[model samples]
Target chain A: MVDIAAELKRPKIDAHCHVRAGREEELSSQRLVEAGEMLGITEYWCSRPITARYGSLEEIRAGNDAVLAAMRRYPQRIRGLCFVVPGYYREACAEIERCLDAGMIGVKLYHQYKINDPAVWPVIELCTQRRVPILVHAGYVTDPRTKAEQPRLSHGADFAEVSQRFPETMFIMAHIGGGGDWEWTLRALRDSSPNVYVDVSGSNLDDGQVEFAVAELGAQRVLFGTDGTMAGCVGKVIGASLTEEQRHLIFWGNAERLLAAQGKQPLAKIESGQEGVAG
Target chain B: MIFDINAWVGSWPFRSLRDSTPQQLTERLRKAGVAGAAVSQIEAILHRNAQPANERLAESVEPYRDVFVPMATINPTYARWEDDLRICHEELGMKGVRLFPEYHGYEIDGPLAKRVVAACRERGLPVQIPHRIEDMRQRHHLDPARGVPLAAIAGLVAAYPDTPIIVTNARGIAQSPLWRRTELRDAAWYADTSLAEVYFQGLDKDLALIVEESGGRHLLFGTHAPFSYPEAALVKRATLPADADTLEEISYRGAMRLGLTPESWAVKAGSA
Candidate 1:
């Protein structure tokens, strides 16, 4: 027997998985535990959803707190981020400050909330001053334009602008900056502020674009992540191309530095295939 | 073992034929470390007459007989389908039959399809019916497969019960409602993992898991023949590695029980 699990056991660090503790319709907690076990990934974070009426400040607090609570319950395995609509900087700023001080490591901006908008300035300013990383939904030009109204999974250009505006905050250019095209993404990354980093979060195929990011911006800019709940179809074709070295970086290396710089222990460092060790 | 169970052999007509000759297909497979491959003709999928396509497919494949075992496509709608089948087995030396039910305007449950299936079984060949050729939303509109009815095909499996049927070009099994029915379950049908996971939905075990749970054997592999980067399938297959026994069953043993002779099946045909 060729030990298939070994063939797949390079380890994974899901830098941007959705942290939906209260929602069962999508990725439930029980399913997350099992899936984490199966894919050999122990850490992931979910972004909070932006809403229609946008809930009350307390309601927003609960949403952020709920993800923190879930991570607390499984402290040895998960990481989390508090999501805020970029359009509501007042409530988003308060939530970001509260969550960051409480030990939440990152910030998430999602659907319909344009990164280019002026309202997101407060949160961006706080992230820059505090050095908290932000993962925005950056999509390609050809994708449904409405994703901007929903969830923009790729936001490189806006990230560039924001990264330039806020030098201290580390911006993760997620999904290889627009559905895995290195050439175009490179132009965006190269043009962006040096603070911008690309996360191989959802798409882990290690395309030359990823190499391009590493080549142009250095490997420290590359982070590993899985869209977790929907790591199929996308992961299948793309995962095939990832080499073991890239897996190590995306899984935990970049994440470790990000956390250590923030004065926190990296999530259950299982490197050397050990029970627990430094990542 | 990870194998591309559904790739093509020669140049495909819808797009372009494979970039390589038959020997090139073998060389390509070898580069991926694949021991053997079960290959079909891409040109046969869309060419109105299966003769020229079949003829070129057979001739191109002759030199690499050991590594490239052929599965001839017999369009039940083609003028000389029976002749194609005969030339495939007796003349070209194929060990299986592939069907394009949707493209040919015939149902898998139709009488001509049964005749074709019977001809294949008599000659100890496994029948291959692909569910689709191109991505439904991505096809160029000039040549699009009408798409087969998965339920009707399931019905055919229920009727046959004992016959071996392999569905290639298999994708979107998750979206199919027929397999979800609690009242009906067909144990005889199987599928190849082509166009299976283009969505990154973690649907790797989706169809196979369903088939396996339903007491069905869903053969897992890729469809790389004539594809631009045929090695693309190899990357997809790597995400899905079966255990030794499961690999034995899918990569060869199970196909043998379907009536594929020892001369053509992957495991038996080569040291791989």
Candidate 2:
């Protein structure tokens, strides 16, 4: 009666989808919600425009508001995470402040802006001061990742300095460090930084890093994030290590805790994240 | 009711024992809600001779006896090809034989490859061959040599139209409308859900076209183990937007059609 079955049947969260200023520009947030519903994915955190040229506060707000509008259409199923280039901190911080006021839960950093660069240092300061999690694109750039992975933002190596600089701030490394130049990224996640949590998004876990990561960093640290393409979501999660209880955590429990702590409501149904199109 | 024709049961050198064991793998299969699977050995593919590995594979099928069927890997290049096929057929009762022509380094049209394909045909055996596992680029080589061409396999299937040959490694089937143009009507292909899926490439016409052209009976669910996660394939197969009848044909009956039961296989000269 708890609708646990329906909730269990709910779609997975696509932690890193994009708006592209085109794909979803005119489509109603309801259609976006429908897309998520069809796939049983209830959440979409838009993080495209990850480049230096996308270095304006206005660009961040446009993408951020697009995602927020989707969330508004299906309040229970959507949440928007803001994207910013670390090279422009004041601009990035200004957008983050706006997103925070609008109830965003996390900050997204593209590798185009070096994590170690002074430009991003202030963005981290802002996110940390506000206690929002920052997700970074960490992995090898040349490893022939699918076309969905673009703009080889600096690998996890760029951010080792950032994590060291701010130990209390939460850092989520997308792809769990195995995408490319993975070993060092894994090393950083496991040893170099305490607040760093790795997600198996848009990466292959076939090499046993998922279990190893769970062993090194508790299951709580491995957040589930897919690059948000249909196939990417399936491939990333199908190969993870969480047991029945833990899968619930990676899928939603952990996200629910993080969102609730920030005053957000968990999606109650499987249709919350549906894309609006019927085809 | 969903049958996963392309899955594996054996220890993988790199993947942990959890996804490799029969019990663990079967449970994982069941979790995907597949009714049955046609299993082969990943460990055997590593065997240099493919004899002990074939023998080892036949034995691996014991635990999942009810829900699983055996597939033997044959390296006809091995000096004992005749003996390996005998043991695989008579002793272990494997339903089919899988070949790795690339790893074995033989052309599908070559004498040895044709001989193995013919041997299975003579004994009413279904033959399977994996093209390549994992993203070929991610594998050991940097863009390893191309798999035995689908056209080449089309040639083999055309040669022996009576024998059912299931090719597991052909990534080209989903893209080629030529599957409809093939002269081999008795010939068919199995889509390893692992390799069957198209990703960020944004090209998904292959599966739809193949399903339509082959009338769905030509498709079977397979997962190239140690190469891809089986659950992903299952999800892909389940999510295929085909009609109910077509879905049943591809997911379940197609594999059964590829199989030769003990009775049919046991049919001998005296009975004939």
Candidate 3:
């Protein structure tokens, strides 16, 4: 069998990750970097951790502060995503501006509101104007047994609806393999505009999930991410039945290109002092 | 050589799976360096009468006994389940029996399930319970049932301590509190790596930890083949941070404890 960890020596970037402070244990920046080093990850684009309840504007600011601090502490190993709870539109817009001014590259939306909810339009419009990507928490509906009374989750179709409305904005359907409706998610994103991409994050490792995504949406549209565990994410891609070129594209190239398109530099090139190819 | 404890033949009702036929499956497994696999029939999970599926599985693997070990599925929900178990053990010569209580609409700890377990114990046959064949979330729109509950499995484990019970297709079972319970931890309950793989940082420490917790002898290597790429599971096993002897135990010896010996079971179909 191929030694995937040994063979993959290129600089890789995690397009989806979180940096948290306070009670959260696993989402700390130190933990993310420690885990990243094990999987040969060069950099990570991180968002703030969201709680089960709707966080106040002050809570969102504190989360973004942790992200910005991580980017500052590990200048070349971390990038920031200003997390927003779009229902607090005025406060979310202000926080987005504050983080973007601090050199953060994108926006991260959690389950505070649905993707298609009209309340999120201002944030979507802001992302489009700035050419930054938005990684949204989207998944299939819960099983009837575990279904909550008022589930405010977003599905693939919801992402499609938002992506169509904001054609210029790059929308990442986080965790295409997440939840029961991943197949439905992939199909919904297949015909949507090129601005939409899928991240291979989350805990669900269904067989042939990555291959199916690559086959349907093309390798360029799939980005590698570890919702947390670096080894699990790397194993998912490396153990997949993909060509070396396809593996490279998913592991690093696609992320590099996506960041570049947003006028952002991956920490690897910045740390190596390489020429600004994108610029 | 890797001996895969979980693999399937025939079509799944939900999605299109590659390598469904015996030739295709064995070839795929062989290419991935898997020496042999214990295969069950997909129809058994969906069909009301598991006898035909078991017979079909035996016939399908008759020619390839050198590489395929048939594991007959016995749904306790069906009538004459004991007779089915008899046929599976005597007529079909299957090395073990597999059950899908959730899919078949029977409780794992119910009387019918107990009878099936008793029969397998009497025959010295191992019982393989698939927590689920497909991810509950990813099941076909029509099939809404979830995987067999861990509590039911725990009850069954407590009920039958001597029966070699192997759980297949259970992802993340290692981290569950049930895995740590004294009743389950001390029992001869085993798990396959098909869905139990967990990785942190750059190491496959989750699998290694599972081996340590379950005793290296209690964990078996399985691919959940056809539904998953055979190489995926093989890569996980090969990459695990374990010593050669421990790896050997997980790859083959663990199943040997369940009486699935390649020497006895894999000698070209009829000559044995």
Candidate 4:
């Protein structure tokens, strides 16, 4: 058996993580960083889960504040994303400015409105002008419950439409494995420009899913993301049918390139001596 | 040695997959420390009649009897499904039979299904139901196949409490409330780990919960290989928080309920 703990020591970055401040059941900054250290994750790009927990504008601000606070607390290990409810256009834009002013690198959008809805155009345009990537919640609409809750939730086709409309904006389709028709989503995005990328996160670990993503989008277009767990994300990449270089790209290299594009530097690198330490 | 209850052989037309042939698959499994797998053919799920593909599967695994246990697919919708089951048990000596109700365009509670279930019970053969052959989202664009409904499967399990019934490729059902149903929990029904991954808050809580609720004896280790990487399942298995004995039960012992024994597989002399 592969020593997963040992394999995790290789420097990596989790591009998609949720920080639940004040919620002990959820991950705190200290716990998140500690988990990252054990799993070889050098940095985490975080958004606040509180925004989704409570949908009011005040709660949304609180969520963004939590991300900012976590980033401040763990400057070396945490990166912040400005969480916005696109329906509240002005407040959303203001929050984006506040996060960017505070050195947050990107934007994280949830299911407040459809990805392609006209109301979200301003936020997309702002992020495009700022040259920051927007990580959108694009999951499969499987059952009645999900369909009812997120009637306008973005799928692969919707994401494709959004990416096409704003070619300059970099959009990360969150959860390529999140229970919606991923195959349809992948195929829909197959011909999409390089501006569109995917995050390998979410709860579903269907076999060959990572490989399928890599095959369809190429390693460069796929970024390693753990919807908030190192073990979940790390295992998918580590257990994939990938070479050392491909694994490195998914684990850290691809994320590094994305972060570097935003003028951010990883806090640390996996030293050559650290390779295969646990193995 | 891991025993994968949900491995497959044969090409998938929808997407390109590695390790399709028996040799490629076994080499892949062996590298991941998989000692054996109960495998079926992908063609069985795609074809109108699954008998030809079933025969091919038996023939393909004949050369590697020690590692690959052939599980034949019988489409009850087909006219010759009874003969197919007989050939699988009497002729090929297959201990398990897989049914693809959705792919075959039939419901699990249909009269045909009742007949098939009765036959398997009479013959002392285990019936395996694959809830979803491919992630419905990733299935061939033109082929609009979906998984067998969880309720339908529960009804069938309720009807035949005495027969050994294993559900494979059921990632969604395992996470649902139905997984904890008293009727299912009381019956001789088992679930394969092919689609049972649960990643939440840095913990594999779904797997832990399933093992806790169903008991380790009701879970079987499955990779859904060729369609999925064997290493993925092995990695999940390794990370399961269960003790060594419980892990042993999930990996191999649970499968013994289907009447498989280590001695039943004949490893050729000098074979790796």
The per-model DockQ list reads: 0.16, 0.17, 0.27, 0.21
TM-score of each: 0.71, 0.73, 0.88, 0.82
Q: Give the top-scoring candidate (lDDT).
A: 3
What lDDT tens digits, residue by residue, belong to model 2 across residues B1-272? 56666677776553344566677667766765665677788767666687776677666667667667888888877887888888888889888888877667788767888899889988878887676544432333333434667767777777776777777745556555326555544455455455554332122345555665666756777655434555555555645557888876776656666663222322431264
Candidate 3 CAPRI level: acceptable
Which tens-of-lDDT digit does each residue in A1-279 have in candidate 4? 555546755677788988875554245677677666566677888887432332887887788788888888888888898988887889889989998999899999888777889999999999998888899888775555556666766877777887788987889998776656676678788657677889888655655778778888888888888785345456677778787777777877777777777787666755654544321
Residue B86 of model 1: what lDDT? 91
* TM-score for candidate 3: 0.88
Assess the local accuracy of residue B193 in candidate 2 as a C-alpha lDDT between 0 and 100. Answer: 50
In the range B106-205, model 1's lDDT, one tens digit per residue, is 7788898888877776776777777766433223446554568877777666666556677765555645543554333445556654554422333234
Q: What does candidate 3's lDDT look like per residue over B165-254, in tens digits?
A: 888877666565447566667777888877665454322345657766555756888878888656556656755657888887888877
> Model 1 - which docking category?
incorrect
The global C-alpha lDDT for each of the candidates, from Candidate 1 onward, is 0.59, 0.62, 0.76, 0.75
- DockQ-better candidate, 2 vs 3: 3
Residue B221, model 2: lDDT of 72
Q: Write the per-residue lDDT of candidate 3 for residues A115-192, one digit (tens) a residue.
A: 889999999999898888989877775466423522667777787787888887898888865566677778877567
Can you write out model 4's per-residue Cα lDDT over B62-96, one digit (the tens) per residue? 98887888888888888878888898888986878
- By how many angstroms RMSD does model 3 differ from the true structure? 4.4
